[model samples]
Target: MSEKATRNFIDAYEETRAALPGVGGWLARRRESALDSFRETGLPHRRLEDWKYTDLRQTLEKAAFAPAPAHEGAVVLPDRRSASAFAAIDRHVLIFVNGRYRVDLSQAARLPKGVELHALADVVHEQWAKDLVERRFDDTRQAENIVDLNTALMSDGACLRIRKGVKLDKPLHLLFFSADPGASHTRNLILLENEAEATILETHVGEVASFADVVTDVAIGDGARLNHVKLQDEASDAVHLATLRARLSADAKLSSFTLTLGCGVSRSQSFVLFSGEGAEANIDGAYALRNKQHADQFCVMDHAVPACTSHTLFKGVLDGESEGVFQGKVIVRPHAQKSDGRQMTHALLLSRDAAMNAKPELEIYADDVQCAHGSTVGELSKEAIFYLRSRGIPEAEARRLLVLAFLDEALDLTPHDLARDALKLLVSEWFGEAVL
Candidate 1:
């Protein structure tokens, strides 16, 4: 069943892709091929194994396809609790909206002494850009539609790097805004050189029934470290599908925090591939769903080296017929002995209609490795509720508080304290004071 709306959008997109400047016949040909794939595949349906539980085609068919009109130059972050530590973090920041870079709101002139940030559009034509892409993103073709399409049509995104052995005092912020009812697709490729270390915050926000499909590819060189926080709080009518892929070299370390809040149908997929010995990765997140909404979070950790470790803990709270999906996979290759990987997912259903679906998977080829995964779907504990009510709290309030407490372990894993608090307050406001 093809939706005429999506077809109409594809038509408009064809025209827009044709009219874009500076791209040559080869690039345009690639865009046409990608658009053709999109036309055939549309959005992945539930029948597809990877998309078995997500019927994204239904939501995407209802979206508008025209790129959003340009807006005035001012940075507007979604409101958070006043005391968010992120507000004071002195970080290099890039801002984008509706698939275009926001120059005014973005920081360009003054970054750390050795740091360099360039918009992808500005550098794609340069010889260095080709060299960088060849070396850093050679594995991009292995990804899905949103990723390949972003590569084919992407004109602007961020390219960031810190010099070897540099430790910066501030964080790097990548902020995305949908702002209108048009579908937005963008790509970002980031790299960290040897011995460099940094923290980055990536966030997306918007209103209206729209779509934001994005991909961020990161490559960490030897001895480098990256702390990434992904915050997704788009409009309830938005379909937000994104991938954050990271590849680490020897002795590299990566820590990631993913927040699944806002949006009607949103999913964040993370692929962390540890390619070097002694590399480390940590994944953590918290999500809350309400009002018939749905949020899907999935991650894969590939252990391809010896003496590596990865840890994952994701928790969710569902209410009002909202649903949560969590799928985690840990793969340890045969020779990758001494690998320690652990995964856990827990969900709390606040209503009979609210539901959770979780699958924790472990595929181990090395018998000497220690890898384990566990998931549980359960209702609020009556004993905990009774204990809270005994202290004079209302029954509903007690349940809400208990659920919030269960989610704290995931949120506390973030290095940014303020973002965690802001998310807590957001859940409170959305679910009422009972949840705080």
Candidate 2:
């Protein structure tokens, strides 16, 4: 039998290729090559070692989503708190509705002298953006087999580039709202030159059953620093798939964090490569899921040079028969001496039917490296809940307190102070709704 979903995507690409960016240039050729790769592998399924727990091929076949249309009329933000969780933060904002940039709804002004920001179509021809898009990672292909489809169909996204020794005045926020049902593909590119520093925030929200596919490519130069924070809260019937790839040069630093609270089926993938010595990458995330939702978080960090450091931590809460998964690996190359890497994943189940799957692995080829990985899946401590209740708190309040405390450890890892508080508030509200 033929793969119906895969064939649909192939046909969609042929139908929309003319309207996409880079009509006859390098990106057009890149898209053709990417589509060829997608045809060869189809979609990732249980047969793939990395996708043993999440069968994307099966799920997409069932959804059978078509291309989403551009939301033209007044785009009203979703009523949920997740849609405006970071509105109070002082930052430059860019809004995209139904995968198309909405400049009228965005507020970006007075960028630093060396900073550049544009939509995907505006900067598609730039050499820097092209380099970031075409860069390849290590020999890990199975995990990102679905990325080929995104490359071929990605319609619009944010493009940010910071010059050498420059620092952004405030955080740049990218907000994506799915107003109507259907599917959309978005690609984001970020480039930081030597000694440059910037912070970025990403938010994904939807109101109806939709399919969201996104890819972000990052390149950090020597002595540069980049901090990224992402919030995902789509409709309960939505499907979200996102992949992030980052390359760090000598003495560069990257701190990325994500919080997932919505969606019926979602997967977040990250691939980080340490290309020069003395680089550091910290990848961490926390999630709260309920209903029959399924969320998967996968990360792989490659230490290709000497004296690099990397850390990974993921914690989540599952309830109401929901399921959570965390799969991570840290690889230290043979010549990558003095590399220090650590990975840990922890989960708390709030109900009997809730399930958690965790796999943290370390592959060290250097003799002088220090690497460790650990995972823990447990329930809220009954004793702790009892103690809270004994302090005059109601049973519902007690449970909420304990859940917040359990997730606090991971939330503290968020690099931004104000954003951290915003996330905490949203998670607390989510818990309150769960109790009702």
Q: Which candidate is the best by TM-score?
A: 2
Candidate 2 structure quality by residue, lDDT tens digits, 1-436: 1389898888889888899888898999999999998898898888777889887877888888888888888988889999999999999999999888999999997898999999999997899999987877754688445778888998999999999999999999999999989889999999999999999999999978899999999999999999999999999999999999999999999999999999999999999999999999999999999989999999999999999999999999999989999999999999999999999999999889999989898888889989999999998787987898888888888888888988999999898999999999999988999951
Q: 320-405 in candidate 1: lDDT tens per residue?
A: 88999998889898899999999999998878898888988998989888888999888878888898899999987787677777
* Candidate 2 global lDDT: 0.91
Q: In candidate 2, how many Å is residue 142 off? A: 1.2
Q: What are the runs in model 1 whose C-alpha is more than 4 Å off?
A: 1-13, 18-22, 25-42, 73-85, 126-143, 428-436
lDDT of predicted model 1: 0.74
Q: What TM-score, to 2 decimals, does candidate 1 have?
A: 0.89
Q: lDDT for every model?
A: 0.74, 0.91
- How does candidate 2 fare on TM-score? 0.98
Q: What is the TM-score of each candidate against the true structure?
A: 0.89, 0.98
